[model samples]
Structure formats: structure tokens, C-alpha cells
Target: MEPVSEPSPDLAALADSVREIEHHVGEAGWDGPVRVFALVRTQEMLRTEPGLAARLDPSVLVSAREQPWHLTSVEQEELPVAPDLETLLAGLSWPSTVDGMAVSVERVVLPPAAEEAMPQDTDAALEYLLAHPERQDVRLVVGALRDGPSWCAVRSRANDTAEQVGQGPDLVPGLVAAVRSTLD
Candidate 1:
């Protein structure tokens, strides 16, 4: 792993930020989990420079609830006018750059149906999310499901594209939280 450049001079200040995030979750007691965000990049980038991901761990990290990184062939109609599942999967595989590095990260697709159940913006967020993928680096795409948990679907951009890998219970939440934090 490449070494981190250097710990910030005010490491204590950074610690405070973490505590603050924890406080928000604690005070509000947001029963739902938080998501971490990341840019889809090449495996080489991840392999050669582990420190990059570690440095971003705090600001972009998230904590998850009871769920797994699931990928099954969901029907097109089931998704909103949000576009085809294949299109999204293909777009994610398409190469993109991050920090001047050639990386093609997978896009996380949350259905419109899933978002409607949440206690947040319930309007047509899916159409906008699909139409403008570049406006935001990474987003927690929410979809509404008629008969699923309000927190139905969630995903994150993966560094590698070939295989569908998922984080362990704890790391997934941190990663989701990080990504969500960055998007917000």
C-alpha cells in the first residue's frame, strides 16, 4: 500500500469531524444506515495506491443496515422511466477518469420505487438521477418499491468492474456513508 502523504497537521481537528458525524447519527438516531461514496477507478489504481482510499475513508464513508450488495436481473418496467438496467450496467463499465487516472467504475442503481418509501424527497428523483450521472460524482440513487422495505435498494461505485464485489457488514456501511457524505 502506498503511504499516505502525511497525517494532516491538525489530526485532532479531523477527529472532531468524525465525532460530529457520529453525533448527528446519534442525536437524530437515524435508524437507517449511511453510505460511503467513491469514484469508479481501475484495479491498478486501487492496488498501487491503497492510501488514496484510506485517506477518503472518513469524509466519504457510511454505515449500512441489514442488506447485501445484490445484483439480479431486475425487469425494465419494474424500474422507473429510469432507463434500462443494461444501459446503466453498460455505462458503468464504460471507462472514465478519476484524478487523471483511467478508471471505469460501476454505477449504483437505486430504483425510483424504493425512494418513495423513504422519509425524504419522494418526487421524481430517479429520472433526474438517470439523466444526469455526471452532475454528481456519486449519488445514493433512491427508487420506490410498492412492496419492499422503504430502504429498498442501495449501491456504490466499485473500483473494479469485472467482478461484483461487496464489502463486509461493517466496511459496507462505512463505504456507503462515505459516498453519501461526499454526494451531500
Candidate 2:
């Protein structure tokens, strides 16, 4: 990695350079092992306060990140290619650092069919999904509005029976945990 020597002389040009770096990285793909590490020294030197970091949007970070193998959901959408569930999970708006790599989750919307599949009888399908953990990872957060039909949404990490929309079917959280507990 190139050491940070000094800020660039041309501010506008430097911004453009960063943009290109992001673009090229994204054009690559996420294939190899991943890791994410935050350098305290660098953060301290840059004076990135905790509040600022908290306020920063994970979507922006995820959007700019690069993986080594597959096209991100965002990229596929931009290409107008419909992406499957696996692709969407790989690109959701959660910041992850694996094997010193960092990527953010931008959007985690469930697909139309999946959302519709959310059973009218809340407990059964959700229970089934929980029963089979493998199925959980493949599903997205698509559900109907509180009073409306199914739509797409990101299920909460905290609640299961309560989806983000009104009182629609529950969206399970923490796939591994839900499976472990339910299966146990």
C-alpha cells in the first residue's frame, strides 16, 4: 500500500483521484478472503471524531467498496440486471471487515417474489425459515406495508415477529442465531 505522504496540492484533482480509486476497486470484485481493521493511529491523526463516524452512512461506504469476484447488487441494478438473493446479501448496507477488508451494506431490500412469499400466517413460514437456517440467508427483507400488501424492507436485527412495516409478517434477524436457537 502506498504510504500517505501529504495531502495533494490540487484539491479538485485529488477528489477525482479518489473517485477513480473507488471506481477501479469496485470494477474488480469480492472473491478472496476478507478482513477489516481500523487503524486507531490513523483515525486519531485524521481527527475523525466518534460522532462523525457514527453519523457517516454505511451505504456510502458500501457503495464505494470493492470486491474481487461478483458484481455488487448496486452494480447489477445499474446494469439493469436482476440480482438473486446471494448477490443482495453480499452488497447489503452493513459495514464488514473480513481478513483486513472492509465493505458496507447499502441496500437490503427483499425481492418481489420473496416478499410475496411471506406467508399470510405469520408464524409458519418464518418458523420454517428459522428451522432451516440455510433458507434464512437466501431470503431478503421484502414485506407488505402495515396495512398493505408485501413490499421490500430490511428486517430489524432486534425484532423477529415485528417487521419494519406496520404489522406484517416477521422478518427474522441474525440468521445464524435464529437458526441455532430455533433448531435447538
Candidate 3:
């Protein structure tokens, strides 16, 4: 994962917006990894989803029209514990090429066998799960666009990639979408 940079004024404002969205989605209480995707200028998205061009900000569309990578920077980092989510997000900045952002969150669900052995204490449960990997069941990856396009994928613990399970507006809505919207 790339090291996150200090957030510029614009980035800070964007983070604040995302925090509100996350609060609405209850992600503030979720224990999981958050992946940030920087949407830069690229033709791939236009090729795959031509209609997206119409919804994008005109300035972004024009700037990215000739760029090689539409999605330039993708960084996956753990949520910081201190300074709060808004503060943390506000401190990070994206390259000038970036026009939008999205966040992907993942949560691992334990299987019955693992749940049966779960400890009553939260910390103990985490330790128990770490000690016994077999108890893990599905890992859910949720992708939410700032503009409201949401998608989710699920995979067994043994699998390397997740399979798309569902996608659409408000399917797995949250702070990720709010962050993405800031780019717009």
C-alpha cells in the first residue's frame, strides 16, 4: 500500500463529506479494511460504461479524455484509530489527475464452527478467530461509488478473488459513496 499524504484543504473538505456518509451507513462502527480508489482520467471506464461520461463533471471528462489510466491511484489502507475518520481523510490528498474517489470495505464473516467457538469478549473473539482460521466463512467486499453506483462481492476465505453478488443504486450505500461524490 502507498503511504497516504497529508490532506490539502480540498481533500479535507472531501473527507468531512465522506464521514457524514459513513455515519449514515453505520460504517463508523464496522471493523474492516478500507480501500481507496482515485478516479483519474482514463478511457477504460468510458469504454466499459459509456454512459458514465455523461454524468461526470465536464472538466474532469475533458482533462481525462487523453490520459492513459482512468483510475490512476488505488491505495488500500487500514482505518486509522486516532484523530477520527474525518480528520484522517482530510489530511490526505490526491494527485492533480484525480477527479473522483471511491472506497471499498471488506468484512469477514465467521462460519458456524467459528461462531460456536467465539469468545464473549470482542478482543478475545478476534484473537480466537486469528488463532483458528478454519472458522472463517465468507469475506464480503463492498464497493460504493461517490455518484451512487454500488457493488458487492463475496468469496470464501480460501479464494483469492471475490465474486460479484449484487450492484446498483443504494445496494451497499455508505461513506464510500460520499467520498466518491466529493470528486464530482
Candidate 4:
């Protein structure tokens, strides 16, 4: 098989932004899932929403007139919190040929099996966890460009790991499929 190509500069930037947001939300104690959608540009968008067309680059418009252009949207909607997140995600639908997505999920931290050794006080347990590098909460963020690159970031209760960004369908396969399902 031929080697996979790298993500375009635009997708790379979007992934970086997603990672930044993930870190910020994790620090703020957000232990819920967040989904970010990417809106693409189409000729119909130009006609139905003239203001959108006006804001777009001239070259982009010209290119879009021939084929849909992947213009990432700055606006995103946070879906309502649900009991079954996967079911909720599976129910979403999006316009045709939309491009790109970012998803961040903050898992609730569970005390290790050795909890009996730690202080019973919640505050003290938390402090102990922070003081011990081996025990820390973790948050993961995944970003994807439709039919393109995908990147991921992992953050701990104490610090963010060095980013691991790359181009591949396998980077975050399940998340990518979840996001792609919306566009379909």
C-alpha cells in the first residue's frame, strides 16, 4: 500500500486548538464528554447564506463553486448531557460533505484498589494523589479531519503530556467513526 499523506496545515491547526481546549476543560474539572463539529463550505451555503460567502476568501469561493470546500466552523454546539452518550452520538446527523471534528472526554477518576492505604478524607486523598506522580486522573482528546488526518492529546491531573499528533485513520478509529457518522 502507498504511504499515507500528512494532514494539511489547516487540519493540524484545528487539532492543536482541540488539544488546548481539552487541557483547559480538564483543568476546570469538567468530567463530561464534549463534541466539536466542523462545518464545510458548499455552493448552496453561498446562496442560502450570503453573509457566510461574503466572509470567505475569494479563492475559497471560487474553489467551492467547483467542489465543496472544507471550511472549519468556529462555532460548535455542545450536545445535551445524556445517560447513554454513545446512543446520543449515534443519533446525530449532519449536512453532506462536512469536514473535520474534535472530541474530548473527561473520565471520572476512580481511586485505585489500594484506596485503603490512602487517607479516607476526600481532600486528603486528592492531595495524596497529586503528590504521587503514579496516581493521577487522565483526560483524552481526539481530533480528525474527514478523509484526512487525526490527532490526539492526553492530559493527567498533574500535567499535560507532550502532544501526539499524526495523520492516520487509525489514530482514533472509534472516535473518528463516531464523528464521521454525524456527517453521514
Q: What overall lDDT goes with each candidate model?
A: 0.28, 0.28, 0.48, 0.59
**Model 1, range 1-184, lDDT digits (tens) per residue?**
9876743322222222233322332333222333221222223343556665565434232211111111111112222231543343333221222211011122434456644443444354556555643432222222211111111122233322212223121333433332232222
Best by lDDT: 4
Query: Which prediction has the highest TM-score against the true structure?
Result: 4
- Total clashing pairs for each candidate: 30, 26, 9, 0
lDDT accuracy of residue 112 in candidate 2? 64
The residue pairs found clashing in candidate 4 are: none
Give the backbone clash total of model 2: 26
TM-scores of all predicted structures: 0.19, 0.18, 0.39, 0.52
lDDT of 2: 0.28
Better candidate number, 1 or 4, judged by TM-score: 4
Cα error, residue 78 of model 1, in Å, equals 23
- Model 1: runs farther than 4 Å from truth? 1-8, 33-184
Better of 1 and 4 by lDDT: 4
TM-score, predicted candidate 2 vs. hidden true structure: 0.18
Q: Give the per-residue lDDT of model 4 (tens digit) for 1-184.
A: 9998876665655555565556555556745556555555456566677788778778767756655433434435767566664676676665555556566665434467645577889899777766764554666666656566666666665554445322333455776677666655
The segments of candidate 2 whose C-alpha lies over 4 angstroms from its true place after superposition are 1-111, 131-184
